[model samples]
Target: NRLLLDLETDLFATCCYVDVDMEEGSAWYVRAGHLPPVLRHPDGRTEVPESEPGPPLGVIRQTDFPMSPLRLQPGTILALTTDGLVESVEVDIEDGLNRLAAGLAGSDPSHLGLVADELLTEANRSDDVALLLMRFDGMDVLPSRESWTVWRVPEAVRHARRYTRRALRSWGVADHTDAALLIVSELVTNALVHTDGQVRLDLTLIHRRLRIAVADNSPRTPIKPTNIGWEATGGRGILLVEAMSDTWGTVPVSGGKQVWSELSLD
Candidate 1:
């Protein structure tokens, strides 16, 4: 069970505790005035369920805190964090959650610490951040098409875009071809801007959408521009990606990071 409490008074503080059941991987958790945790599957799916929480502890006595049970299946990832880690006064919560979900899907659990760090660094706004990531093992890997290819430099972006187009078509998502191509270009450009390392692009067609991910040996993740004015001209790359992409985010890897974007066929 994971318990988290957030106090918003003069003394801003966050508290968390974890209790695991030996009989099963399921846990009984509770939240109090804190953001709910998100769950991710090994196959790159993620979500944040509504958490029925009580009033913040210390703010109210005799509060009835409801306990939520979460069963961890093999390859299931459970992530909990405070608003300080992901909240943006200007960005919508739904967009933030979508990006967070994508990041978890592409993140490597072996580097969970780095993953949390990257998330906070990208979205920090002068508040303390805390995160908890728990993953289950022994799950079956989803079956995917064995088709793949490699490219170098400028060719990588164009080649990957073509491959994405084909993959999306195979998934009956031909309409998303253009969006996938643009997303691939943006991610590849970001990679090139930061490093000259070998960039690997992976395009996965699932359901009716195309999942475009670019992996590079760079640690930095994209951030929305803060210096907004009539003459603001730079720092809109991520904004465009977010506005155009169905969803997108970044996952920290062993030596680099994988930034991903999703586009729907319809």
Candidate 2:
């Protein structure tokens, strides 16, 4: 678990990437309101593990963190991030996540270290950022333990729309397709021009809920665009997601951070 000075929200970001191996076939890990990790499989599937995150560190005496047993197999890559990586001045946090995922997909296993390092670069921000990439070898013969893919990139709305749709479909999520697509488009546009590729994206559906996460390498979280002239074209994405989702928030990763949102199924 990691701690962040929530009061000094403007000064710093905490981020981390860790991998611990257990002797058993199944292993359990705990989260205290930390940025949940994205699970990737060799099969090109992606997901955010379902577990109870107690609360961000230092806020309370002790958080009752939930433990989740991960089914480890060969070629499993789990990417975890911090808040400095996603929430930003330009892109909506969610869209930043989409771009991160796109970049992860093209990353090679041999370059796992580079992938984590480049993840921060892709965001193009100065905020403290940390990412952990975990790979489990020999998954094909393992039961229950699967594999997934991750991708990241910097481009315009058009490019985001193309990939978000493909990614959701690839994971067999078709119900709220249009809404997800729109969210991705909005986030991407904000990232390319405003922040330093300072965006991260993750797509996953677990227990019937669709999870979309975007982490920027930036510590600057989104604020309602308040300028009068900004009303029509600005801050609409935040409003759109706030109106369309169940819940959302931000978390400190290692060096910088992350913002996440979720939509419940009909």
Candidate 3:
């Protein structure tokens, strides 16, 4: 939102942003004076969801782009496109959207590339057209996931470690138990000490990899310390996480940020 506000005086653009969580079988999107996404279900039913959009980018300052959520069942196909593909001088936007949805309802989702090409066969040639299509199949073998909310108490770190250890043991990854526990302790402790609002610890085990995630209501990402002397007592949590996990990163969620680290059990 701040980025769009900064551009309010210089540029005019519309955007539709969508984020999909396959594991959760859900999607969240926000439209900024853009077209609503078209969804085709597994049963061949299609509809343009009723989406409330904010003003076009660079048109308003301090605007709140309210997000709309959608549940994506298995074999659901989602389509997002620009006006060139759906609207023309001869056709109204509403009719164009209906036509697009109808076209999507008849296409085969297995051939997404071909489906995209077919959708563009009737696009307005005078303008640039863009289309993005996604088919959510959901996970065939869902990973084992457990989440625990951390209370604002002194024993939070210990409790986090205990949870991590138990989860790792149950998943048959006891070999990496110590390392996972340490990583969880550091991440949860950092979230408790540095941020406010609710804190949560999540563990996901899929195959031979284990993922540890700590979510907090703050959007500020953890910063890594460049240099630490012998006397330094803090600013090493992120560093420890990096050193212990095969991969680690942070992502923005609905109202907060999630710091996640992945470990390979092999």
Maximum-lDDT candidate? 3
Instruction: Compare the candidates by TM-score and give the number of the best one.
Output: 3
> What RMSD does each model have against the real structure?
16.9, 19.5, 3.0
Off by over 4 Å in 2: 1-155, 225-232
| Candidate 3 TM-score to native | 0.82
Per-residue lDDT tens digits for candidate 3, residues 49-149, read: 99789989877776789899999999999999999998999998999999999999999988999999999998999999999999999998889999999
lDDT tens readout by residue for model 2, 1-266: 32355454433322222335533434566665566666666776666666666665555544465576777656767787765686577866566666667667767766688878777786646676666677767423321221122234443456556666776677666767888776666555554445564455666666567766666666666665544354465667766666667886667655445656677765
Give the RMSD in angstroms, all C-alphas superposed, for model 2.
19.5
**Model 1, residue 239: C-alpha shift (Å):** 1.5
Model 1 lDDT tens row, 1-266: 12222333444233333455533667677776666778887677787877688766566545677787777767788887766666677666667777777788888766778877766666666766667787767424332342443456567667767776777666666765666677777777777766767777777654555677778788887777866676776566677788888888899977788888877665
Model 2 shows how many backbone clashes?
Answer: 50
- Report lDDT (Cα) of residue 106, candidate 2: 69
Computed on alpha carbons, the lDDT of every model, listed in order, comes to 0.69, 0.61, 0.91
Number of backbone collisions per candidate: 1, 50, 1
lDDT of 3: 0.91
**Please, what is the TM-score per model?**
0.44, 0.42, 0.82
Best-to-worst order by lDDT is 3, 1, 2
